[model samples]
Target: MAHRYNLNVFCLPSELVDTLTPRALVGQPPPREPSPPPPTVAPLASAKGCNICLGATFADVDEQRVHFRTDWHRYNVKIRLSGGNAITESAFAQLVGGLEDSLSGSASSDDEISDESDAVNTLLSKINYTSLSDVPEDGTLKAPLTALTWFHSPPSTQIGVYRMLFPLDTPPSAYLSELKAMQATVEGGRKWAMFLVAGGHFAGAIVRVGRISDEQDEVVQTRKRKPPKSKPETEVLEHKTFHRYTTRKKQGGSQSINDNAKGAAISAGAMLRRYGEQALRDDIRNLLRDWAEDIHECERIFIRASVSNRRIFLDYEGCVISKGDGRLRTFPFPTRRPTQAELARCLQELVRAKVSHLTEEALRAQDEAYLASLPKPKPLPAQPALESVEKPKPPRLTKEEEIVREKWNRLLDMVSKGRLEPLKAFWEREGQDLGGIDALIPEWTGDRRASILQVAAQAGHDAVVQWLLFDLHADPTTPVPLAWTKDGGMESDASDAEAPPAGSRRTAYDLARSRAVRDVFRRCAADHPDWWDWFGIAHVPSALSKEKEEERDDKKKQRRKGLREKMREREAREREQERSSEVVFPVEEPPKAKKEPPSGPQKLGGSSGSTDGIAGLTPEMRAKVERERRARAAEARLR
Candidate 1:
């Protein structure tokens, strides 16, 4: 007979690895260092299951026969190698180690195999208890599996697969550690889930790891409408997973199914409430269906805005991320292109401010109007019309005028005669009685008022004219006296004996302006310049020189000439009185008369015709007469 080897010796279940019987080999054992042959199969029935041992056994079988079928053994075997759940060969090691240690301490008993089987079952119970302690409180092992869902195959496949749902909402890190541990013990590596359909019954797996990208898409590229508050928070939930296998091959496999999806966003640990899970799934599906459409809109925004060229301008309500240098900047948004909702809010605010401002304005206007309506004033009584009153005509100077001039002349003559008191008294009595003479007097009188003033141009009397305009209410825009004069009296000598006719020389208008009337000139320029001739009065040089010289010389002559006549009268009266004194002779002595008669015979001049008259003197008489003659001659010489 040929030696026999039982290839079924390799089969073991997760619950009873420690209670299996060791079968002896029929042939000699192979050397430790012998070359290994290619793996061969035995018939399926050659290995038989033992419920008490919980292990497979095989008798020798013909060549090309495989003993592979073991239902109880396979179920335990499958779970012991799965990656995500706690059922695995590594989990069984935990069960086996403790079981072997408990068996080693027991004494041999009649039911030793039965005790061993009971001990294995008890060890399996302990592992199950510990594993249950580690399951999440969410009641689903996939709850913490992150954005990736894993899938496993039935008996046909050795490893499982993984896939990333779009818009994923689980973290990637949650499964990575657990998967790595599972991959270490499983021959073909751990598989991840892809889909869970109709609850957990029909789970599909793709043995590849899938992952969403870490980077985010631009928010402006995603939506024109305002995103909900949950948008950014939701992005953290999107993720990806990889269907990976622990394999040693010429080339390593890709790390994840979504390795090419570099910019996809994902969330972590974000879950709906238990009751809202279905709703969340529906939302996710809808979002997935609309994702491409949303993405295309974002691309359109990018194209239309030309954000890269600075042509696509995004008007944030306030600040947003800066296009330059990836920093942030702020600017006031322009009025145009405001979002409808934002524009509505702004207009509401503006209307409120404007209404407030208008209310203030109305209050101010009302206050002003009320103040203005309080009180006012009234007019006073009217005065008599002075401007319409006719000026009194200057009293006509009768012969008294001539007499007055004469008296003035005579009084001045008396002053030259040194009769100063009488001259002053005459002025007080007569000149002062002429009440308006003060007004007529010029400022520079040269001690003779009329003569010097007569030659001066009327224009020079500005002070007098101002007094007339302001005090006397005279008008200035009237013709001068000369304008009416025909006989040149207005330019005449001061010695003229007769006055010009009332209307011939000086008119009231002329007199009014001759004085420098201020208000009169102002009023004339304002209201009556057209009424008066614009041409200035012509100044006659002859009149100028003659009036000046004649006035001066005539004044002096009048003073001296009157004094000369008075002096002539006084000398004439003295001569007449002297002749009368000579005519009334006084009587001489009688003896002198007799002596004169005798001497006269002796002849006075020795002429017979005048003998008596000439002989009247004697020698003594002749001597006396000679003495008188000598004295008289001396007196005459002295005179």
Candidate 2:
């Protein structure tokens, strides 16, 4: 439907419109220009520039902010606040002076103060500082506070003040004087502090210089146990305190002061109270004099200082003296001299800084000089004279005895070589004087105690065996004489000419059975069966007998079998000859003739006197018989 529609404009309420629009747009005064961001202060001309976190420079506000927010900057800040980082004495003094100037300027100026300026003022007011020459004697500030003030100061000022306060090159005596002056200034029960700046660290002590006395015991009413009247029940004793000081930063880190400092301070103070200060000084002078004398006497001296413990160690020659903690530790000289200066240097370095210049050559020279100074050792006591001793001479053998020895050696040689003839000759020549062929050689004992028969068997000499068994008539059955069982269990005496000692032995059969002589035994058994039996072959071990029997049976069977085969071949040949003869000459039957009785004796031959007896025969019959005989011979030749 096409119909005319009326349009109505809707408007926001005046209150809503006002709330929606910002104040600046509504014609209200705009927020004042954001205060123009407070102009950034220009970096100072004398600024050493940040070496940490910010690098060499902070080029803009953003860079400066970034640097300050870094962890490196934060860690350095923490170190400064904790007093772990230190500055020179001069630097600290300068810082204090600068702070004083800043405070004065801020007070005199009419300019409004800012948060940073207020902070600077607060830090300045907290620090308690004075000139080195005009430090207050009764100042209440302690060393920790002083150290903290120094650490919190500007870096440049801290360095300058620290350098001025504790010069590194100051002598020990100067430091001591300064400490004494500081101690004198402390008031009430307050302690005096003095620090030595050495090796870039602060090491010193805090001392309560004035004397203090107190009564340790007071009068008391006893309840049950009472003191004896003689001993005095109520005692009033006054105790005096002297040389009471605590180490502030001896050495460094967590190390405490050694006992040497404590003992020296205590003893010196006590001596001063008891005998006056002059006496104490005199004792110190005397001690220093003695030390000087010792140093001069030493060939080489090592002066060492421990910065951490503020101790000194002296090593000279072979002696080691440790000076620390309130006591001096003196070690006895080492026996083995040091070969090089490195040992002393290492030892010095362990306890303190090394001050001696020593080397291997220098140490060697010093050691030589020290050794030369020592007294010469006494000569060793003369050794007692040894008594002369005479050894009994070996008895010289007689000519006869020498000859017997020679013959005996020769016999052994011949036996070993299996020379039957030579051995027999040697025996024959010495048989009478040697008592008998069976007489044992003195040297042939133990494993060598074999008889002639055994020796021959061992030599594998059949000829020697025969000679010994038959010609020499050696007792084959004789039991070998063992050295242990010889001559009725008595050791054989070589000097006894009548009867010789029997030696350790074995049997001839046992010797022959040895692999070295086995062949000889086998040959003997085969060549002389009768002799082998006579020699008691049956007495051999059953195992050996069975072996021999089996071997003999095998040989016999092989020989018989071979002979039977030869006989069969011969019969075959004979048969072949007969067959050939019959084929060559046929047998003819004689005409039947009247039987005639025998007269005297049958004629043995006919008139045909030829060996074939064909004189009475016809030519044809002779020829036939000759042919048969030739054929038989040809057959026999073929066989």
Alpha-carbon TM-score of each model against the true structure: 0.13, 0.22
What is candidate 1's lDDT per residue for 279-363, written digit by digit as tens? Answer: 4334324433444233222201111111221211223232121234221111112232223333333222211111011233454
RMSD of each: 59.9, 51.4
lDDT of 2: 0.39
Q: Give the TM-score of candidate 1.
A: 0.13
Candidate models: Cα lDDT each? 0.32, 0.39
| Per-residue lDDT of model 2, residues 1-639, tens digit only | 111121000111222222221111111122222112222334567433453322335656666665454333433343344332323324333443433223433122224243345323333234311121122123211122121011111111110011122233544335333323322212222222222222222222222222222111123224335642332211112111122122233443221233434543445534333343233324323443444433333222222223432332222232233332122221212212222232332232222211123343554465455545545433222111111222355768899888877776777678768886677677777778766756655763333554666666655677777676556655545555444232224346533534433422335655563553544444444544555442453233322244676897899999999999999999999999887865334433333454557666665654322343444677777778777767777887999
**Where's the lowest-lDDT run of ten residues in candidate 1?**
297-306
Question: How far off is residue 422 in model 1, in Å?
Answer: 34
lDDT of 2 at 185: 19
**Model 2 CA lDDT for position 349:** 23
